[model samples]
Target: MAANTDETTDAELVAEIARQVPDASADEAAAIAVAIGAHLTDRQRAAAAAAAAAGSEETWDGKEWSFSGRIDATQKRHVRVRQESPTDPWSAAGRTDRM
Candidate 1:
């Protein structure tokens, strides 16, 4: 929880960041939110694209992706991960070590 940015004052921005990346650090979430606020900047676009492409077969609830897959490595950053990267029958778009 470290938001040293002036944008933190905006409750909407903070909430949106939390909604998108709940586990993200305040600073990381803020940076992501700010970039996303700007009509989806390069980083934001890449992240969204990765999310969309990863769980193309899953259902999205506007936030996290829901898919039927075996447990695999979790990730902190949003990036493209190939389906065959893991030998598992299916791999989740993303997972977390914490609940």
Candidate 2:
């Protein structure tokens, strides 16, 4: 689901989550929303980390190419990442370094 986290307040998240689980108590709904939100936040962080792992950047250079991702070292974690403009001539020519 596309979301603007900056505009998604905690209470709003709780309310939305409660709406999804109508049977849950207010406290239960809030808790579920908090947990779910945290997971989603972590997922985003992991993906961002993967894109920035090589350095403090979200791209390969001052060009159209770009990369971003994250790696979750936690017990339940897995790989998450993204690379843009893979069809660029430089990429097609095969560069040795990986972002």
Candidate 3:
């Protein structure tokens, strides 16, 4: 079968399920993952459409960086981040807790 391009495959999903439920047998994990995926397929499609419609973007100006996007389908969110130095990790720029 062709590999999944945009989402995890059943095998990958089963593996993750098995990892989370160590006591479950491989067959059991596979069955559960398949069922969950089937049940959520329509909801997943709707979420993808909503996220695409909401859109997101990231911008950088020297050390300052900003991202504007929906944190989830239900709300729009923005996050400002900064890098102290060329090698520094990006960090929340200001009071992002309220953002």
User: Which has the greatest TM-score?
Assistant: 2
Clashing pairs in 1: none
Off by over 4 Å in 1: 1-9, 40-99
Q: Report the C-alpha lDDT of model 1 over 1-99, residue by residue, as the tens digit.
A: 222334334567867778877788877776666655554345677898999898775433422322222122243334433443332323333332222
lDDT score for residue 64 of model 1: 34
Model 3 clash tally?
0
Count clashes in each candidate, considering only residues at least 3 apart in sequence or on different chains: 0, 7, 0
At residue 78, candidate 2 shows an lDDT of: 41
lDDT of 3 by residue, 1-99 (tens): 112335554787898999999999998887777668666776788899989876742334543432323222224554444332222223432334544
Clashing pairs for model 2 are 46-70, 47-69, 47-70, 50-69, 50-70, 51-68, 51-69
Task: Give model 1 RMSD, 1 decimal.
Answer: 19.5
Prediction 3 global C-alpha lDDT: 0.56
Q: All candidates' TM-scores? A: 0.27, 0.42, 0.34
Candidate 1 vs 2: which has more lDDT: 2
Candidate 1 — what's its lDDT?
Answer: 0.49
lDDT of 2 at 18: 81
* Residue 47, candidate 1: C-alpha displacement in angstroms: 22
Candidate with the larger TM-score of 2 and 3: 2
